[model samples]
Target: MIMSHLPYLISAYGITLLTVLALWLTTYRRFHQAKNKLDIMKKLNHET
Candidate 1:
């Protein structure tokens, strides 16, 4: 019955959610790091 499968469904959804969150956070962090690096490079170029 549906009730018997509830635990499996809940775990599957939870795992999927966590995976998406981890991927999002990783992408966000990398984007900021790349942006900072770009800014630093631009400043160096301007100084020269």
Candidate 2:
């Protein structure tokens, strides 16, 4: 049975989780940065 490979399975799942979390954080940061730039541009455009 797969029970014999329990350690390997757990490690695989852990690596996958960390990868997803890293990807989510990177995307979230980029989105906020882009939004801030856009807001600044909009404000400048309105002032002109």
- Top candidate by lDDT: 1
- Please write out the lDDT profile of model 2 over residues 1-48, one tens digit for every residue: 789899999999999999999999999999999999999999999999
> TM-scores for all candidates?
0.93, 0.87
lDDT of 1 by residue, 1-48 (tens): 999999999999999999999999999999999999999999999999
Candidate 2: deviation at residue 6, Å?
0.7
lDDT of 2: 0.99
Give the lDDT of residue 37 in candidate 2: 100
**Candidate 2, residue 7: how far the Cα is off, in Å:** 1.0
For candidate 1, list the clashing residue pairs, or say none. Answer: none
Total residue pair clashes for candidate 1: 0
Q: Which portions of model 1 show Cα errors greater than 4 Å?
A: none
Candidate number achieving the greatest TM-score relative to the actual structure: 1
